[model samples]
Target: MNQHILNVKRRTSLVTVFTLILSVQLGFIAYSGELKSRVPPDQLQEAQSLKNPYSVTKEFVDKGRILYEGRAFCSVCHGRDGQGLPVGPDYDSSSQPLPTNFTDGAWQTARSDGEIFWILKNGSHGTDMAAFMPQYVSEKEAWQLVTYLRSFQGA
Candidate 1:
């Protein structure tokens, strides 16, 4: 009878330890917010603006070039002209999942800046486009890329 009670106590202790470890891991995931998909709506709108708030002289297109070449490496797949390369899907190809042709005026006109920013940060999953961008890019930088992409519209 004593042996049976001791075995039950040992099993209880092991379960308690396992529960504690699982709770800690779950708490960490909740604190980090890794499970969330979209940015807050207010922040998304502010980040979507096409003009720089700091200075009248700086445009988003100009800043976007710096980001494209430097941090984002956007040119690797999209090309300098924003006419996407074969590294990903061709925007114009019938056989491929059409990427957004930055050069398409009608398409650009239809999309809001917020929509574009969402795509950039979240990426289109299940496609060749792995989320190439990180949320670490400043809101200013995101707007800049928006402007730069607009430049290709109707070009």
Candidate 2:
């Protein structure tokens, strides 16, 4: 009886959390009629203030491409071209928001170089995004990916 009660309580708590998250997402859309970014306001501001540390060149793009495709395997989730949509839980088990669409000029424009780098370093919370710490990829490599991802704009 105690075990059953505990299970019920746990399930109820999970449902409540899920409902709250869904409600907030719905509220954001209804209020603005715009897709709400998963990132928090403080993170957004901090990311916006950052600047790219390196000048983008073909060599840098190539290097980034290697990391993004190779060890990183970002392509698996983000796609080869790096364009994806948030496939909800029905389609994907994780139900994390979609991978970023780098080709979207307006979307890319809204994010700062620092923001991208920060995401790469720290990863976004409340989502499936995993941080690529310096142990996995150096700061320079992360910056290279930013350059490569930005290149998708206008293409």
Tell me, by lDDT, which candidate is best.
2
For model 1, name the residue pairs that clash: none
lDDT of all predictions, in order shown?
0.65, 0.78
Clashes of each: 0, 1
Indicate which candidate wins on TM-score.
2
- Each model's RMSD to truth, in Å? 12.5, 10.1
Q: At residue 21, give the lDDT of candidate 1.
A: 99
Against the true structure, candidate 2 reaches a TM-score of 0.69
Per-residue C-alpha lDDT of model 1 across residues 1-155, encoded as one tens digit per residue: 99999999999999999999999988986644422323455665664553434442355478888887677877776777777665444454433444455676666766666666766766755455545456547666766776677778788
User: In model 1, where is the ten-residue run with the lowest total lDDT?
Assistant: 31-40
lDDT (Cα, tens digit) per residue for candidate 2, span 1-155: 99999999999999999999999988877644323444567677766677876888899999999988899878877877878645655766434456777887777877777878888888877677888868689999998888888878887
Off by over 4 Å in 2: 1-39, 85-89, 92-95
